[model samples]
Target chain A: MYALIKAEIFKLFRQGKTYYAIGALFSIEAIILLSAYFQGTNIIDLLLENLKQRFYFEGTLLNGNLLVYLILNTLWFHLPLILMIVVSGMLTAEYKDRTLQTIMLQPVSKWKFILSKYIVAIVFTLLVVLALALSSFGLSYFFFGKGDLVVYLNGLNFFDASDAYYRLRWSFVSGALSMVFFSVASLTIAILFKEAAKTWIVSAFFLILSNILLKVDFGDNWFNALFFAKLNDTWQYFFYYQINWEQIHFNSLLSIGYSLLFMGAGIYWFHRKDIG
Target chain B: MLFSQVLLGNVFAQPVDPDLLKLKSRLDSIQSFTTQLTLSVDISFINMPVKKAQMMYTKGQKVKFSSGDFVMLPKRGLDFSLNSLLEYDFITVDRGMEMQDGKNCKVINIIPTDKRADFSIATVWMDTRLRRLVASEINTKKDGSYTVHFQYNQDQKVLPDKVTVNFEIEKIRIPINFMGKDTDIDRKKMRAAGSKTGAIYLTMSNYQIKTLL
Candidate 1:
């Protein structure tokens, strides 16, 4: 199992597609940072325009914390798509190049082979998210500097520099859970389809449709129960001054359960199939 | 002897109404005050929790708010100072008696002599018995119209214990440009949607008033 996982990681690195995925995430962050460098203050001015009428807003509004928050907002939609692309290719590429038959004929167990792919996909997802966090923080901090963060979620919410630092960091950390779910789900689709194009199309459609469904008002609990909606809102948990441990625990459990269901189904289907 | 007595009585009665003079003196007695206030705001499209803050005000127009966390207070309503209104050159006219809150109050209109004053006209209802301003309607060029109602305690000082401000404001709409579309057009649509009338209820207590005389 260890050797299989090592070989999988080695194969992932050898492919230029893996670097492209990381590059894509970096490029998005770069564009946002550059835009912030030139027109960052304007964005802050626009958000604060209405509030300025009622309150005298002092201190730095455009800063590292705020820039990171904005970047996360953009990443919520784009990150899943990026993960789907990379993870879907993981298995489909094996099937496409007839490498799956070659690997299956070897003395390796099929479950271990599938598990290795899943584990590597999870690792890749984490790395991509880590890269996103580092670049966003590094670029924005370099350009905008550090200050308080202003959030208009339920209403106008302000966090001082120290509070902003911890909350923003944890938001990214919580957000990685959702990426892991997406990675596993994409892998499942790739195994089921066995064709890269079909897997990509189905996964992309699923993501886009779930996002649309998230906006539909289907009452309270029912709407929140949708995994994509829950995934998108995972970052909000970190905003609480006194963290709601019960709610966080519930959401984390739910996300892990969903990922397991996808993995279980994928493994069962792959094990029964006659690939040879 | 009869003519001289009539002349002396007329001289004693100044052109400024004695009631207005009493109200002015009552309002001027507090040179400064610091109060701890809890503000509850319910405006359209804005959800805010009860905010507690320390508010300090001087005889001049200097007002400041300090809180451990961020507090959002309406700029117009919270700065309630009769002195600030009276600072400008204005002509005070007696508008006769009117019943307010089941009490007979003397109504007076203050018309700004300077056209460039912040508010064009202010109509104040002063409680005759308490010698305190109970309600006021201020029409301004910039800020539209505002009506402030003051509820005072039975204490000797004339400062209000609570205030409710009713004002007309442009409706609050978050300007979202859908997919980088024209925001100006969307803003125009939002504007054409019309304005709203809102109120802020402020409960002020723990007053540390600096007695000016």
Candidate 2:
């Protein structure tokens, strides 16, 4: 298992797509930081237009914590899409190149072979998220400096610097879980399709469909809470003044269950897959 | 000072009432002063903890507010001197006596003679015994009406230790672009909550006054 995991990690690093994923995350961060620099004030002005008339605001609301949060919002679409493309390509590219057959020829356990891929995929997702966190925070603070964060959640939640940092840390933790699900699901899709281009299209469409479904209100709180797509946005719940630990915990556990379910399906399919 | 000039002159042609002059004179006595204050917002939609800020006020200049934390201050109410309210030429009519917050106070209605003034009219309830403004309602030309209630500690008669400012603010109709499942926003509720009559409570202490009469 250890050797198989080691080889998989080695393969991941050698893959050009992995480097592209890291580059994409940093490139997104740079664009966001620059956007936050020029247009962020206008956005803040619009958000506080009503309040600005009545009250004078002291201290900069557009700061490191706020920029990080804005960057974190990309988890809803961009981040996961990128994760899906890269992780799915990991499996599909192997199928295309016949590397899966070469690996199986080594007398490796089928469970370890596939599970190693799943573990590596999860690790890759976390690393991408971590790289995202580091770049977003480092650049935002370097450019915008430290101050309080004002968010338009539950009607204008203004958090001090310390509180904002705490919320941001947890948000990334939950956001990474959602991204892991995408990576696992994408790998499962590759296992099913056995083609890189076909897998990418299916995964992208799946993400968009899931996002669209996430917004469809069922009008029942229990139903809404239980919906798999709705669990994707669990990270955003932390910005609320009163944090909902139960919902976060439940959603986080549910996210893990969904990831494992996809991994299980991938393992099951890979176990029976016949090579030419 | 109310009724500063009758017609482009500095002095009023008629004798101004001493009571109205006393309110302005009481505030004008301090050359400048600084105080630490905690401001709490009481709007149903906005949620924030009390912010600690230092306010600096000079007689003829704009009030300056500074805080290490983010602070929201009512643009009109923080001017404790009532400088803006009484700056331009205005006439005071004795609206007679009224009981305000259980204190029998003299009601002075000030109608601004200068079109440049932000307020159309202001009604002040003066605590003649304490020689201070107990409460006042200022109707601005554009920013809506503001009602200020001042509470002074007996020991610190010059400045009110506490101030409650009530005003009507335009309801916030801005869309929240936040992402999350729990962020199911009811636009109907947001519309209902957008505009509201809110109050800002200011607790002032740690005074550093300079050059008092």
Candidate 3:
């Protein structure tokens, strides 16, 4: 199983598409950083416009921590699409190149072979998210310097620069967990469809449908139970002051359960099929 | 006759309204006060909970709000001390008596002589019998215009039992990008958006007026 995972990583690195995926992340980060440099103050002004009526806003409002928060919000809608692009082809490419039959003829079990691809896809998702965090912080820190972080969730929230580091760290970790869910779901589609384009389409549709479902008013009790709404708000749990531990634990368990369900279904389907 | 002329001269040369002086002296007598207040804010598109806070004020423009959470209050309303207005170098002219809340009150218009005062003009209506401020229209530099109405209990202190503050706030503009491609048309629509008025109702109780010399 270890050897199979090692070979999958090697194959992923050798492909030019993998480099393009990393390159695409950096490009998106660069665009967001530039946008922050040019218009970030306007965004802060809009958020704090109501507060400004009473309080005299002093000190730095645009800073590295704020930039990361803004980037996270902007990328949440697009990061899943990028992950889908990268992971959707993970299994389908093997089928496309007729390498599935070659790999299956080896002494490896079908479950181990498919699980290795899923593991590699998870690794790729983590690396992309890590790069996003690092590049966004590095570039924004260089441009804007460091100061208090301002978030507009549940009204105006101000985090001192000293406390921002840990909050941002946990926020990125939770954000990566969400990406893992997307990556595994895309892999499931890849295995089921056996066609890269169709997998991409279905995965993209899932992302859009989940976003639409998030907005639907199914009442509080029912809406909170919806997996997509939970997934969409996973990052908000890092707001320690407003954290609902029960919801966070519930969502985490549900996400893990769903990922296993998809992977298990994929493995069972692939195991039963005769690939020639 | 010479002593009588000196006494009359001393009284006439003061050139200040005796009623205005009486009102200022009464306001200045209360050096400091602390009150427990419940503030309710109502503005378009902004929902805020009724905040209960302990407010402390000293005579020298010092004010503080002690609350567990963030407290938003109009600065002028929070620091609404008549001492601050009377202590400044202002020209006070009697605007004649008027009926306020069915009581005949003295109207005084105060224009600050200080070039750098926060407010340009303040029109005050005072209940002379009670020596309490009935209402004031203050035109300030940063806050535009504010009209504060005071409803006082028949207590010895000048502080009101309940205060209603009415002020105009510029409409907070939502970002164009957030509104999508209809931003330009939406902006035009927002431009035509009428006056946005905000009012804060403060009920003051448990007053502990302390005179710190």
Best by lDDT: 2
Best by DockQ: 2
Chain A alone, TM-score for each of the models?
0.94, 0.97, 0.92
Ranking by TM-score: 2, 1, 3
Q: Report the candidate with higher TM-score, 2 versus 3.
A: 2
**Model 3 over residues A1-276: C-alpha lDDT tens digits?**
899899998988887787887787777778877887898888777766755765433345678877777777644567888888888777888889999889888898998898898889888888888988888778878887777665544323456565666777777877787888888888888887888889989999988887676555565676568555456657766653456778777777777777778878888888887775
Instruction: List clashing residue pairs in candidate 3.
Output: none
Residue lDDT tens for model 1, B14-33:
24456656776666567889
Q: Which of 2 and 3 is ahead in DockQ? A: 2
Candidate 1 lDDT, A1-276, residue by residue in tens:
899999999998898888898788778877877777788777767766655554454346678887898788754568989899988898999999999999988998988899999999889888888888888888888878887676654334566667778888887877788778888999999888999999999999877776676555565675566455555566776664446667776777787788888888898889988784
**Candidate 2's residue-wise lDDT over A1-276, tens digit each?**
888889889998998988888788778888988888899888788878888878888887888988998898899889999999988888888889998888879898887788999999999899989988877878888888888887776677888898888899899999999999999999999989989899999999999999988878888778787778989888988988899999899999999999999899899988888753
Residue runs of model 2 more than 4 Å from their true location after superposition: B1-10, B13-15, B175-184
Task: Give per-residue lDDT, candidate 2, residue A150.
Answer: 79
Clashes of 2: 3
Model 3 docking category: incorrect
lDDT of each: 0.74, 0.84, 0.72
Off by over 4 Å in 3: A50-55, A222-224, A239-241, B1-90, B93-173, B176-213
Candidate 2, residues B19-88, lDDT tens digits: the string is 7677667777778999999999998788898899999988778999899988999977677777887777
Tell me which of candidates 2 and 3 scores higher on lDDT.
2
